[model samples]
Target: MDWDRHNRHIYNKVIDSFAVIGKELASPVVLAENTYSVDEAGILSSVLNSLKVLAGRHELKTHRGACVERTLITSIECISADSRHLKPLIIWPATTHRSTWTTHPTRGWHYGHCGSGYTDTMISLHWI
Candidate 1:
């Protein structure tokens, strides 16, 4: 039961599992809305940041740099409730702007924006 020893490993494994699930559930149209949820969004942000750092280390040419940066910022804003408008929080530059729909535009920017029902306070605390 000393799971603490492998806590980080387990967390990474779980996150990897979720990535597989996201890819499976996501279709040809891998829109941001399909990968909804604060946890998923946060995971994405973390992964993007890690990749960005690694890319910088290895000097890999990546177009995803901008997309990942935008997504990371949006995810942070969503999780932090820093922005009241979910459009900026959920709208990603990964695809065409006009084709995207407004998702969770009232929940104070957090994923699954359930307006006035903030849950990221706990997550933000853990992150800090």
Candidate 2:
């Protein structure tokens, strides 16, 4: 079968299975209190490549290398089934915190730093 058809078949199968399982699951209130969804995303402080610029028809263009200063930070967010969400956590790639990271820190949010700037078991535990 075609790739699209094959994927659609698999998607339908998974959806059907979920519907069957959902029917037998606990009530909404119980699930809402116990179930949580967590998601993470990596952020780069600067653009990796040069941005496009508007110029005249005869203007000369120069190509610059990748951005010189770039920082990688990971953000993790969690929400429960009933729409309650915890404060977002930001992980910086450093051994210690720096004042320059943010002039005004966001209220209620959390910040942490690690060598790799990625979320690990310890960070996850701390968030929980």
Candidate 3:
């Protein structure tokens, strides 16, 4: 493969131009205080497969068939370069909120629900 041809210098130039413009507009400290990095992660409540197990000779069949139900939970976190962070937004896989889920609530964290346990456009807008 021709590395130089595939590397796309135009895209790099565009990014470098943006960097220059950003540096001209704001100082490092001001940028750090105002800019935030956001990220999202998904968690599975249960795994269907187990790596290690101990079973009786007669119970192997039953053990193989056993599996736990899983729920998909999504969490969105935001932080700034100044070492400050906002409370995470948690997304559950339900159409409506469940009170039992938050028996002990987190003080400032936010929660939302959707049919699929993932962040959609509306959820992202609300978070923003």
What RMSD does model 3 have? 9.8
Highest TM-score: which candidate?
2
TM-score of each: 0.22, 0.64, 0.61
Error of 2 at 38 (Å): 0.3
Considering lDDT, which of the candidate structures 2 and 3 is the better prediction for this target? 3
Q: Against the correct fold, how does model 3 do in TM-score?
A: 0.61
Instruction: Please give the clash total of every predicted structure, in order.
Output: 0, 0, 0
Best by lDDT: 3
Score residue 2 of candidate 2 by CA lDDT.
49
lDDT per residue, candidate 3, 1-128, as tens digits? 23455476567887899899688658745666777779999998866665646787666666764556789999999998688997899999999999988888899999999999999999888887
Worst 10 residues of 1 by lDDT: 79-88
RMSD of each: 15.6, 7.4, 9.8
lDDT head-to-head 1 vs 2, winner? 2
lDDT of 1 by residue, 6-68 (tens): 695688898999899777766766644444434323323333554334444234454345444
- Residue 71 of model 3 has an lDDT of 94
